[model samples]
Target: MATHLTRRGSIYYLRRRIPLHLTEQYNGKREITRSLGTKSRPEAERLARAISVELDREWQAASEAAAMTAEGKGKPKIDPRYYDLAGAYELAELEEQHAAEVDELHADADRLEKLLAIVERRREQASAGNASKAATISAEARKPRSGAKGNSVSLESVIELWRRDRQPTAKTVDAVTRAVREAGDPDIHAVSRQVVIAMRDKWIEAGNSVATVNKKIGFIRLLLGIAKSRGMIDSNPAEGAELPPPKRAVELRKPYDPEQAEAVMAATAAMQATDPAMYWLPRLARWTGARLNELHQLRVEDVQERDGHPGLLLTNEGEHADGVAMALKNDGSRRWVPLAGPVLGFAMWAKGRTGPLFPAKANKYGNVSDSFSKRYGKLLRNVVKITDKRVTFHSWRHGFADMCRHAGVSAEVRMALMGHAEGGGAAAAYGAGDGLPPAMLIDGIKRINGDSA
Candidate 1:
């Protein structure tokens, strides 16, 4: 099959000789050799075939360029593919050396003896056909070599330290770890500007939006910055690497048209008795323009008398009545959203509830609002049949904002009513804690609700 698969010790590796013309581009490396990290011949052959196909394309391109240059009597432009592949290989080789150096710096004679014992045990296990146990020990060997006081560390080791140091959310840790690992998992000290650029290009080529790609790159930057701050590396390779600015107009969420809004309300109203989330969430969002999580995380206690009128308090002040910690998007998100119009009766629905108003929707992370967004999306698609991608559950918030703007509500009152940051100097700061007067809030709410109270 021309897969160029070879056995090195007991592991399978792919070893492909560089074409004669491309050897100079590779800095005189005669062949590209990489471990498949597997012993299964079938799996190794599959991987080797894929790698061979990729290399063949680059080699063919280089040969064609050389032919064209010779005919024209000019120098051929170097293909960036050569440098990207070579850079990955260079970093892979450096990671071994970096790990060894860090180990020497930190390992005492006793520590070295213990490590050698572990290695002996692993090799014995491997020879006895207990490959899984050997593999487990192999991973253990990689981890403790992390030199907390030395100048070099592996990417995985730094990621572990970063997680401990940052105490990032599980979601954040998974995302950052995935991004770094996918970017060739370069040594902490070996990640360069070219490595970051190559990673970005790969994501762009895989059809990620510019925003998504940039977010992933931001994770890499933050991760490498952690290594740099601890003196494990001198600089973050991803510091200045980013894609060109996206040229398309930013797609804003579209507010529902009159028919669409009515359709959603009708669907929700039918199921109000059986599914409270379906019924009340849309109404609340439409009237208050509160963010999805803000409404989802509301406690029954939040639905009470505020300034002698019923309202929903969307603040991260304390825990849920059940003790799940509250989280707000920002301080601006902590304010009173008075009940009015369609949502005026929300307090009645929440009357007997003690903890989360939507307890059934609480995710395992104690974020009581996570599942509602997806459920509402299904309702929009399967039940209401509003299939416009931009017309999501958040569209109710957009519709509420549009309603306020169309009703000639002033910007400051609108900002305060919607829990938006009021940016208007010290004057804006005066009564922020007090929120808009209940009367003013009710007035604006009624105006947007199309009922002049």
Candidate 2:
């Protein structure tokens, strides 16, 4: 009798020759033993001995079975479900064997199909919860009067509508127009998900931060939402689109410290004596933290006393020489910002009754850029020690916000002062509260003036 062994698919096989001496019924179950690996025939014989030992141990345990009538059955009966479980385990074992052979092909079609089914089930479960949360947030955002006005239109159309309706001071209208034009193509209705993703990739390629891309995408989403509401599109493609993850928040620029502050004041004082119009512009900015356009548009009548205290009134509409009426950036932006002592002093010194606070010849908005840089640039450089970070006219507003934070002003008070629309439930319920109570403005003033109290 000769025996042979072979391997196939990680399985071992053995063939045995049966002797012809006995009758076929008593030929002793033609041996077909599986191989355990061995280096030589003696090693193979040793493995065979181990197998014989195991079999004898099993026979000893089953000696009682031979005494029972049930032992006459050829094989034990197996439940159908047991076979099914065994088939599943066998399939799993085969898959593990296949995985070892094809390592890179793990996520094949079958696996993808199973994964998709799980994902869809999870999404269905989450849909209702997400919708409810969105509705709650939208409802709260609509509570304030400013919020209502703000909601009537989107931020995309704010400048266009402002220019059309409000005859804003020429400088203001121009500035807003530039901002709008720079934001170009407000109709992002045709922007696809792939387009947005590409745009984000391009931004990253250009070395922009994820936060920067997110900010632009946020504005893009706002535009798309507005376009949908206005019937410009049937759907907002930006909705449900994944945005790039934001980076850590950066610290905001703060107000100049005392020595730096003195340099700015000294520069303004010197400029006041030399170039009065240019000097008063930055002075009012530092004093009021007003937007550049706001300072540029000031008229004599806009500065007045309310209840024996000086206040500045702002309107969306600016009068041309011909007296045409127009709306401001939005209805919410038409509210007044109170003027403190420094702002009033700067206004009085300028002494303009019916024209711009820093009046320029027609079509000369950009002309003041050089004059502005010359006056405050050096002083800001000396103070901040970084020429790039030197105070711009816009920095006044940023600096004022920083001062407010340093003074421990409440978020509500600071937001109201900055003309930000309230979206919180409590803020919306209370409304604007008759124009940011004078005390808060006074407190803001004291902080800027370096008053300890």
Candidate 3:
């Protein structure tokens, strides 16, 4: 059974035959085969184990489904619904009508028929015991249940449409797109609970944090919701999928202490000549409590003097001006964070800065924050020698909030300065308070920096 692992040109793959009794559940397929997406044997083994566990659970569910069907009939029964393709013409006609030109309409219809043919042939081959031939045709090419709006549409297409309509963060788009690709890019109609569960297991096995796994799953759930709304799927596959509870509250991230902050600032100060982000971003985070991305994505124009005080204006306006799309977490994230004090060095740092205050480059996903996070993490470990796993770059923001509390800043003032949503209440809805007056913010900043007399 260990031979369930195979290699093709240095890439490991999982190849396991369907259990004889379970072939009925797997559309008469004889095996499950998919790339492990890793060249390392140890990593492949871990992923394979995850896949095996999910498959076992899938087989158990299939057995239960089979049992239910058998009890209702004189003999074992395969669901006739899986084989129904009556909506093929209707779906093809829908696609054809969407095509702008006569030539394109014919071409689109032809393409739809070819996809349908592939589905039909896969079923025929599987039923005839030509398992390998059936496997050669993608198992994803199934005839969707007849008479749905988007029965013939691929999940890929649906995802693209959602992206265009919603405009999620680049990181989100990238993560969801990668997750779907890793899951073999099944069509909307083929995305089942089993499929979602299997992908979740694989992510867990790959050592993604609970939060990371949940966030990616959330994307799939959103996509499926869109599918259901558009008649691509009858229901969301991601519903009711549970995950392990998050880390305990005691183990959650804590704000860095004064000593730790001094150490980080001093260490980063040494790199000012070469890596400006290391020197400036920490100070900005400490002073403003702004999220990391907000500080990292700042432009020279964003730094200005408002009401006789220097501050950074965080906004999603002119996003992608630096080749990476910047996102404000919400409308509240767009605020003017006044400089706490001139001693924090923000005034000097912004004096001559032009495009993109930080020099750190965006990765392939059009993000600079991840790069800075990694560099800062390494500094915490190797340079600053702060070994607390819970204390990282974000701790600065936490520390800022804590300082605000100590400074006797009101909840509204603190939340406004930090760009957090004011909780629901009459106070939160007070008129024209979205942009706090500079005099009040400056006073709060002075109190936070312990400069207020």
User: Candidate 3, which segments miss by more than 4 Å at Cα?
Assistant: 1-150, 205-209, 231-234, 246-252, 269-275, 319-332, 342-344, 352-356, 369-371, 421-434, 451-453
TM-score between model 1 and native: 0.57
Per-prediction RMSD in angstroms?
A: 27.3, 34.1, 23.7
Local accuracy of candidate 3 as per-residue lDDT tens digits, 197-307: 766776676578777787777777878889888765678878767586656646467898989988887887777778888888888888888889888888888887778
Model 2 regions lying over 4 Å from their true place: 1-191, 203-216, 230-235, 240-253, 320-330, 342-344, 351-354, 361-385, 408-410, 423-453
* TM-score, per-candidate, Cα-based: 0.57, 0.47, 0.59
Q: Report the C-alpha displacement of residue 320, candidate 2, in angstroms.
A: 6.7
lDDT: worst 10-residue window of model 3? 425-434
Q: Return whichever of 1 and 3 wins on TM-score.
A: 3
* Candidate 2 lDDT score relative to the true structure: 0.50
Best by TM-score: 3
Q: After superposition, how far is residue 159 of candidate 3 from its true place, in Å?
A: 1.4
| Candidate whose lDDT is highest | 3
On lDDT, the stronger of 1 and 2 is 1
Model 2 residue 10 lDDT score? 24
Over 1-453, each residue of candidate 1 has an lDDT whose tens digit, in order, gives: 244665544345777777656789899998888776543355557778898889889999998877887879766567989788777765655565456435544744766588569756754654433444333333432443223345545576677776555445445666776665545455565566655676777677657888789888988888788877867666776886767666774555789999999998888787777988878888888888888878877877788676677888777665553335566654556777677766777888789777777765346444566777878888899988988888997887788878889997778778877776667432343224376677777677777767764
Q: What are the lDDT scores of the predictions, listed in order?
A: 0.69, 0.50, 0.70
